[model samples]
Target: MPATPAPAEFPEDLTLGIRELDDQHKTLFAVLDRILAVSRDPYRQLDDDGTNTVLDIMTDLKDAAMQHFDQEETLMDQRDYPGLDDQQEAHERFLDDLVRIEADLMNGTAVPPVRLHADLADQLAAHVREMDRELAQFLNKSEK
Candidate 1:
């Protein structure tokens, strides 16, 4: 019989050149993968404790992700970063996706495990490219 593969991992290229931001992004990626795994494990029906664990992970993802955004926003404010608004909008969209996932899990829905993971990974990659990298460049430029 074939074996199931391991869960998803945070891609190296997603690093934003900001320690806290990068760490949180990595954590979010892992948490998302974990959530998806738990939700899809046919052998494990999420019991109350399992449900609470998933909920806790979701809360952590939301809190840590928002905290990273706050850190980036604070830095942007300090540098008067031009791309701050766009970053905030993207952050809001990411948070909305998390809320939807959390709601689905709470309601015992299918949760679209694979697609949700893929969507979050894609969003993170795109956000890093579109927003975080720009901010990183601005910060580096201003430092020189």
Candidate 2:
């Protein structure tokens, strides 16, 4: 079997000023980085223990992501944001994907690390560029 691939590293340009959301994003990226590091290290073979560690981290990330989405959705509702439904749906999709990934991992059918990393990076970048960017703009406009 082929070895797992490395995780994608986060770019600095992906920042949004929403504190809770930003922190969750950072944590998710860090966990991804950790997974990549473990997958890529030739000298360090990841045994079952290490694999379990990765799984745990992924679980934590998933939980945190759900919380972040909830908080963001609440904010949108409170502000009566015009794009609320679409944004909430996007968040729901993200959570669903994470749950699917977790299930795959548990069932020993996990996707290759590289593919997972790429998918996540693409989604996150798109999300930040489209949804989060709009949200930030709205917040800024409201503040002004």
Candidate 3:
């Protein structure tokens, strides 16, 4: 198993200037980091204990993401943001991805931990910088 370096700290550019959402994003990144830390070399196949740890964290992440998405969708709805539907669709896709990953892990067909972490991190950062940032801007503008 090749040793892949853990992911860097969460990128500052991902922050959307909304305290609640920013904090939730941080929590998600932190959870991703935890997945990397479960083993010394994430490229290695996980042992039973490591697989269990990853599974547990994935569950926690799914729950957290669900709550965060609900809060975000509620805010968007209240503010009448035009992109609410797009955001909802993206959120659904993300949740679906999580379920797929969890299923793969449980079925013993998962990719290495590092790959999983990288894929999830990239997807989340992209979502935040695009959809979430747009929502934040709309929300902030409506506030003033």
Candidate 4:
């Protein structure tokens, strides 16, 4: 049988010109891949251990993302970036969605559906393409 390909890394174009934020973005994608690997395995059973692993991955992603946002916010404050407010709003919405899902998981109100993975992937892509890319452009322009 042919070996399965590894998950794709974050693309080069998404770099925001800032080393720290770019590194965080790359790490976020790695973390996402890690989550998918654990959850989507063919033999992964939906038992307590499997569920806890998912929760742990999600929590780790949340913490890393929030920390990235804080560093980005600090950079924006230093540079007086005009889009800081909008970025904060986007960050808030993203984190809020994560918290809601985590809460549901913890309370056993709803099981994590397979589609949840796709939804998260889609959201992250759109956020990076629209919001993060835009910020990168602004910062790049500022450098000129």
> Which is the leading candidate under TM-score?
3
lDDT against true structure, model 4: 0.73
Go through the candidates in order and give each one's C-alpha lDDT.
0.73, 0.73, 0.90, 0.73
Better of 3 and 4 by lDDT: 3
Writing each residue's lDDT as its tens digit, candidate 1 over 1-108 gives 123336666667777677877777787677767766655452344666666677787798889788888887888888999888888888898899888878877877
Q: Is candidate 2 or candidate 3 better by TM-score?
A: 3
Clashing residue pairs for model 1: none
Question: Higher-lDDT candidate among 1 and 3?
Answer: 3
**Shift of residue 141 alpha carbon in model 4, Å:** 1.6
Residue range 30-135, candidate 4, lDDT tens digits: 7766655654442333456666777888898899899989988888888788889998998999899888877776776634434456566678777778887877
Model 3: per-residue lDDT, tens digit, 1-144? Answer: 566675659898998999999999998888787888888788887888888999999999998899989998998998999999999999999999999998988888888888889899999999999989998898899999
TM-score of 1: 0.79
The ten-residue window of minimal lDDT in model 4 covers 38-47
After superposing candidate 2 on the true structure, give the runs of residues whose Cα lies further than 4 Å from its correct spot: 1-9, 40-51
On residues 1-144, what C-alpha lDDT tens digit does candidate 2 reach at each position? 455554555566677776766777777677656656546542344456556766886787687777778888898888888989999899889878877877777776776555666677688778987898898789878878
Q: Each prediction's TM-score against the native?
A: 0.79, 0.78, 0.94, 0.81
Q: Model 1, residue 21: displacement in angstroms?
A: 2.9
Clashing pairs in 2: none
RMSD of 2: 3.7
lDDT for model 1, please: 0.73
Off by over 4 Å in 3: 1-4
User: What's the best-to-worst order under TM-score?
Assistant: 3, 4, 1, 2
Q: List the residue pairs that clash in candidate 3.
A: none
